[model samples]
Target: MKHEIRFIINGESRSLTVLSQQTLLEVLREDLGLTSPKHGCSTGECGACSVLLNGEVVNSCMVLAAEVDGADILTVEGLATDDELHPLQKSFIDHHGVQCGYCASGMLISAKALLNRTSRPHEEEIREALVGNLCRCGAYADIIKSIQVASRARR
Candidate 1:
């Protein structure tokens, strides 16, 4: 059955018709044309499909589109405002946290969620929060440093 859902995406309100079984990531990429959230391990094991659901980090690949009805969703593309990058995004560039760039979007969203809740997360907390995100380039140090830099800048 197709269901009509109203949700806020990237700070914009949208109404979409979606299948009950469709994942948010699929809907975002296929239906809405928001492709920043990559389709990695569709099983939610990979944080590559991470997004912010109501300001909390979630694996979009694991979330049903119907479940997000009337909810607020934020994709990596929403991080920038008026062509200005989010602090995390800027920090990632400044710290060279991106290599292959496949995991960058998810990592940025995860970091954004963490900073949203805690403006200044400790290094250990940052590491723990990002445990789900796997960067093939092994840029863990730079990623952590980027978050720290963003956190400091936000203070």
Candidate 2:
């Protein structure tokens, strides 16, 4: 069954017809052309499909598109403006947190969620927040450093 849904994405209002069985990741990547949310593990074990749903990080692959009607969703693409990048993006670049690009989107989203809530999260809290996200390149150290850098820079 197809259902019509309205939601806010990247500060923009979007209305789309989504199938009941379709996941948010599917609707985002296929229908909306938002490729920042990757599909790594459909079972939600991998956080490659992470996105901010109402300012909280969630696995898009695990969320049903029809269920999120009228909800606010934010992909990695929504993080930056036309002229400047988000602090996390700059921090990621500065700290060499991104590698292979497969996990970068999800990792970035998770970090964004953390920063939004905690502003300056402890290292352990950072680790706990990102535990679901996996970096194939083993860039955990750099990613952690990137979060720390973003927090420090923001303050």
lDDT, candidate 1, 73-143, per-residue tens = 99988989997998899999999989889999999999998988888899999998898898888988999
Cα lDDT of candidate 2 equals 0.93
What tens digits encode model 2's per-residue C-alpha lDDT throughout 1-155?
99999999999999999999999999999999999999897888889999999999999999999999999999989999998999999999988999788999999999998888898899999999998999989989999999998998997
Task: For each candidate in the order shown, give its overall lDDT on alpha carbons.
Answer: 0.92, 0.93
Model 1 has how many clashing residue pairs? Answer: 0
Backbone Cα, N, C clashes tallied per candidate: 0, 0
Off by over 4 Å in 1: none
Candidate 1 local lDDT, residue 93: 98
Off by over 4 Å in 2: none
Which residue window of length 10 is worst by lDDT in model 1? Answer: 39-48
Q: What lDDT does candidate 2 reach at residue 119? A: 88
